[model samples]
Target chain A: MHEAAARNGITARFGLDFPSFALDVDLVLPARGVTAIFGPSGSGKTTVLRCVAGLERATTGFLAYDGQVWQDEARRVFVPTHRRPIGVVFQEASLFQHLSVMGNLKYGMTRAGLSPEQAGLDAIVALLGIEHLLARGTKTLSGGERQRIAIARALLRRPRLLLMDEPLAALDLKRKSEILPYLERLHDELDIPILYVSHAPEEVARLADHLVLMDGGKVIAQGPLSETMGRLDLASRFADDVSVVLPVTIGAHDDDDLTRLDFASGAIVVGRRPEPVGRKLRCRIRARDVSLSLGNHADMSIVNILPATVTALGETPVPGHILVETALSGGERLVARITKRSSTQLGIRPGVPVYAQVKAVALFGE
Target chain B: MLTGDDVQAILLTLRLAATTVALLLLIGTPIAWWLARTKSRLKGPVGALVALPLVLPPTVIGFYMLVAMGPWGPIGKLSSALGLGTLPFTFTGIVIASVVYSMPFVVQPIQNAFEAMGNRPLEVAATLGANPVSAFFTVALPLARPGFVTATILGFAHTVGEFGVVLMVGGNIPGKTRLISVQIYDHVEAMEYANAHWLAGGMLVFSFLVLLALYSRRKDRVDA
Candidate 1:
């Protein structure tokens, strides 16, 4: 029964020593959602991803996914990369130069021994919006298009886990936005859990359900995205990226071309409505964009104001800044960064009621 | 002007060159692959040994081969023990000498090609579920086609042009070890100038055409 109780998702533990760096980490990741391993360059983010994919052999490792042991260094049971049922997307869209897009996709499907009916290459192409590129040469694709093809190729393998190493790091701003929707569709439709390695907080914020914060070749923090980002102790680390990810349902479009997004507490207005009413969305409001007031200020220039109670307060790395955690009317959480001088002047503390004037809300999809 | 002896020598030369090229390819691919991928300290020494024949005089190799393949030598002793006679002054003697004389010609091009391939394509193949052996044959070999062409031409041409090594090892046995280059030498020694001109002219044109074809095919592949 104890061994049967261990039947869960992926658990990866790795200890790798290089001449210039060493990485040691142990993590238990969810089996169904995207888990982001976020860190700066050389923070061992990609190294961890490679280890899970069996690409890099760690000195000491124990990796198991859904009760199957992929690696156990002590036992000398190491599954080679080719034998592991996983797919990887590198920073560069490393397509086979000799193969067209269709050829590349078919290569994965064939190698994985998945038939067209099983892998559904046609459905995947439709999902990634790569139907037009099937016959085209890989060399002819733009950076974003190539990356989309790469993602589709990886997905067509029907991998148990997908390891993506900074898939959008090589794209420009315009190209990133161009490929984001396809990624969102993948995160929505595919059952394959993804281990996404990235240095960009925005990418992590947009895509991740679970967050693993890495530093100095080790994991410093890991938890649900909303809770991890709102933690007072971790606020200083994510100082510039302190934002609440509020899941809201689209209510109605106002006459002034504003979309009404309703959460547990209240509705917030954003720029022109995107998806139709009733579609769920996530809105990210940065702490700095939020200003606190004792009561409602109707004459303020800010468009959105919601009542909240002070839950906690913490210091930021910047000397004059203080980050405030507040519970909205329906127990939803929000954070605001104000000056320490104002914190004392306003007598802001836990259990005190306040009004938060939000400057902008960046709406992302479910 | 071409006599029956001339025809025999030409046929023998073609046969020797073909056999040498085939053997070199079979033995050189793995050696070149190892040299390209190895990080061992012995790589430099082994590479120098393979390239030794490139810079050394053909007669020097021929002298060594003659001494090494004679009845009293180690290889000759082993061959006789195996029930085969000594290798010197025979067709196999010239063939063996030509393989040694053209080792670098077959190895260097393939080695350079493998090195230029880097590690990405093979890594990609591995991620696509190909083992190392399959990756080498499917991805690495196909991508290194131009190198194979260059190696084949160089190995064949160098074997056909072998004279001093063939003479030293085979003792100029007519229709047995007398290759095109050795036959030309004999014609010159016997004052048969016109026959020498025909064989020599044919070889010159043939080498040029082989090189031309290799370059064109390489360029076409690059363009494609």
Candidate 2:
């Protein structure tokens, strides 16, 4: 499996210079699944996507995806954007205003010489919930609706890769929630690799499988999303939102306004979730929400008390705080931020047994 | 009460205007698109050359065209060498002169339209598997309909009303080089006030209608 994955991965190296900006990136992105380029504005995230899409040619670059060479500045070999098999979802949708939704969708299909059945137009329309909007003019649609049609249009081309550059940045909160489930459905069902660019932590946490964290036109860290998010050393870069991601399966729905989720080590109870039993979900455990105790306190209001062993401890950015990395019995890792005074009082050190009282678990739909 | 000469001149003017606009659409589109999208150092110089006619006096343009189309001029020598003979006083000579004189009228509006359409739509089209040529036809041209309409109207009207350039390059031959503007000059020179008034009144109404149509269409586009 490892050999097969390495053989099929995408390798990209780009270097560009402008009067006010410079971008330099070298990435070996997964050829399948969603890999997010997470960064702040002006950090060159979108520029990287544009380079991959061939919309903006890098001054010096090389890109080879799954044995196909898309660009090589050294060889003077560059495929024009139109000939590249890729679909792009811009931030504003960028639908052709003169065309109806159906016309816009057909634009790609005709250009690719693919019939409706071959392009899976019916399935895509149903998947994106845009069947009712076939004949509607694009200018008349709302922001969320326009984005859905844009996504459907891109998919109709049956591109080998899909690039989404901050696709949700233009929408309001309600619109964002309305569109996110469709995006998740696309991610689950589609076979094409997706390079999603965004600066929103919540959006990245909810959807990304692999993470590429960037700052000031440089990549700070990159790895699997769960492992990267759990690093205590990088906690300061994310401000106070550092946390660990737990892959959980829905265990049971109780009558006491709670649902049980089974993780590696133990079961966690959270507020009621509508997902059915046995459904897989991701839960985020914020470090600040956990409290360390030397022994299980029966008088505490927190219901979660799982046995854990101190694995490592590091100083936090705050003057009087410390970050603790602990391993549960099942070898699952959890991080907690505690006051330095509390750590001294509890005599917390590596190999010492403790109980972690988890105050919250943020459940995400599968 | 139109005479045969008046009718001939009117038909000739219509044909000339139609031909001039058709040629402008063909020749000016690429120039306009290039001006809109190029950042090269030559853009300023080329743009100034295209706009030179807008500020120059038509009589001066007429004088230069007259000299260039003369029997010994370079264009005349080339055409003569090709067995096409000299261009002066011919219908084709007036057509060539009109094309140069009315160039900016046709190019500027189309250039503005292309500039107003930012790079997003074309980029989207490219990612959807359209080459640059196909993207221009499929996306750029459809969005630039208003600009084309303006160019056609302006190019046609400016060619119709031109007097100095036509008189200089085309030596007022009836049924051949005798355009409506030249015919009006004939009526006035002969002191035929009644004929002059008839042709002049017709031109007045036609120019007003063309401008009225342009402005009303522009308003509709804005509201849409």
All candidates: CA RMSD (Å): 2.6, 2.4
Residue pairs that clash (backbone atoms under 3 angstroms), model 1: none
The lDDT of model 1 is 0.88
Overall lDDT per candidate, in order of appearance: 0.88, 0.89
Q: How accurately is candidate 2 docked according to DockQ? A: 0.86
Q: Give the poorly placed runs of model 1, Cα more than 4 Å off.
A: A1-6, A235-239, A314-320, A344-351, B1-4, B72-74, B215-224
User: Which 10-residue window in model 2 chain B sums to the lowest lDDT?
Assistant: B66-75
Q: Give lDDT tens digits, candidate 1, residues A1-366.
A: 312322676888899989999999988888888899988898999999888877789999888888888888888999888898888888988888777788888877888889988998889889989888888988889999999988888888888888899999999999999998888888898888889999887888889899999988899999988888777788766768888888899999889998889989998988878699999987888888888999797887787999999999987886799999999999889999999988999999999999998998787888
lDDT of 2: 0.89
TM-scores of the models, in the given order?
0.92, 0.95
Error of 2 at A330 (Å): 2.4
Counted clashes in each candidate structure: 0, 0
Candidate 1 on B1-224: residue-level lDDT in tens? 78888899989999999999999999999999999999999999999999999899989999999888888988789889998899998999888889999999999999999999887778777777888998888788987777888999999988888888888899778888888888888899999999999999998999899888888888887787
Docking class of 1: medium
In the range B6-38, model 2's lDDT, one tens digit per residue, is: 999998888888898999999999999999999
Question: In terms of lDDT, which candidate is strongest?
Answer: 2
